[model samples]
Target: MSTPGGQWRNRETFVREGDGIVDLLTCKWAREHEYRLTKEVWAFRENRIAVHFAYEWHDEKGRWFRSCGNENWESDENGLMRRRVASINDLPIDIGASLFHWPQGRLPDDHHPGLSVLGL
Candidate 1:
């Protein structure tokens, strides 16, 4: 993934390869309390896709936050993601304000409301 501060060389940007990417996700998942992700929107064309997403989580001190982000992805011929760029912002929320009330796993596609319907 090519986050901010990544540089391009030979048509490829700097990316966190292999274990670096794994470690990054591991650390993020490890730190958050009750993390939940909800995909808000997606647009696709050719070999690229753009996704708008939102997630809710709390810190160790019980402070809650809603993180909203957009991610642009480019895939290789094998359908593997070759590049990803993301932009994110976080907003502090009240302790009991979380909209996601489903169980601690994938949200049910038929029952759950998306971000737009929830006025996120």
Candidate 2:
């Protein structure tokens, strides 16, 4: 599957384990700065979930952007995500208009409204 930063790789080629997924995430995060993400589950069923997510980040040049997307995920019997499909769009935003204001890492649990309530 193609990730947000235009990294296109066949998900099937990678082993369906946490290591491969973590590698991909590490690479993605390494290229992104001040990244913050939020996801809201829209639907869920046995071994499958539908979610809408948004992430905010700034480029090396300090250009800020908000990437929004919807993803559908399928998991194996062990609850490991075996497949994921996502469609995303990026929009530029002024720094002053940015919504995510937490630290540079994982957001805190008390951060309310998330992307959905903020109409991201």
Candidate 3:
């Protein structure tokens, strides 16, 4: 999850599948206003995948932010992620400068593939 100061933290246990879902829910709740995310696969081999992602959102006071990150995921035989490590950086952006223009949800298939396409 991300903090108000732009720090990321592993606040939930990943010992069980349910725990991850709960953590996601909690994190979403913590972020306010028009959250949109896009992720692209960077590489993959066997049970591991590397991804790059960017998300745009606003705070309660309508301050906009763009967060970019890279994640490494390791999955079990069932294709469930067993381990995930992420490094992220958040930058404040003006609303007009934001790149994620989709409505507040999943990006459409026709949207740009990743941050590189948008030069984010």
Candidate 4:
């Protein structure tokens, strides 16, 4: 996968081909109190999809951030993601400025305002 730092691949996993990536995610976000992801837009054609998304979360030190990104996914014949690419940017925000305040985990679609409504 590609990141702002450069191309990335796991060099530490002894099992899962990309388990190092999962490990990083778990270390960074697994215990975050406000980690939430919201989909802003999506486009699909055949085996490929493009997505625009944003998420808000806080680090262990309680510094808040809103991360926005675009991702491209290509699927194989079995409809599994064969390749994934993403570009992301993180912006620090005030702790009370979060737009996502629904109960942690799943956001109930019926009562929630999306990115457009919230003016993200």
What is each predicted model's overall lDDT from 0 to 1? 0.72, 0.74, 0.71, 0.68
> Largest TM-score belongs to which candidate?
1
Candidate 2: worst-modelled 10 consecutive residues by lDDT:
2-11
- Return the number of clashes found in candidate 3: 0
Score residue 41 of candidate 1 by CA lDDT.
44
Q: Each model's TM-score, in the order given?
A: 0.81, 0.76, 0.77, 0.75
Candidate 4 accuracy as TM-score: 0.75
Please provide, for model 3 over 14-105, each residue's C-alpha lDDT reduced to its tens digit, 9 standing for 90 to 100: 33345545666576668757888898899999988999888888988889988888888777676666666677788999999988777767
For model 2, residues 1-120, the per-residue Cα lDDT tens digits are 422222223322333345665676777677668888889999999978999998899888889988888888876666655677677788999999888888878878996567768986
Sorted by TM-score (best first), the order is: 1, 3, 2, 4
Q: What TM value does model 2 have?
A: 0.76
The ten-residue window of minimal lDDT in model 4 covers: 2-11
Q: What is the C-alpha RMSD of each candidate to the true structure, in Å?
A: 5.3, 5.6, 6.3, 5.9
Best by lDDT: 2
Which stretches of candidate 2 lie above 4 Å from their native place?
1-27
Q: Candidate 1 on 2-118: residue-level lDDT in tens?
A: 433322221122335555555656667776789888885488999888888888988888899898878787776767666667777889999688888888888888878888888
Which stretches of model 3 miss by more than 4 angstroms?
Answer: 1-21
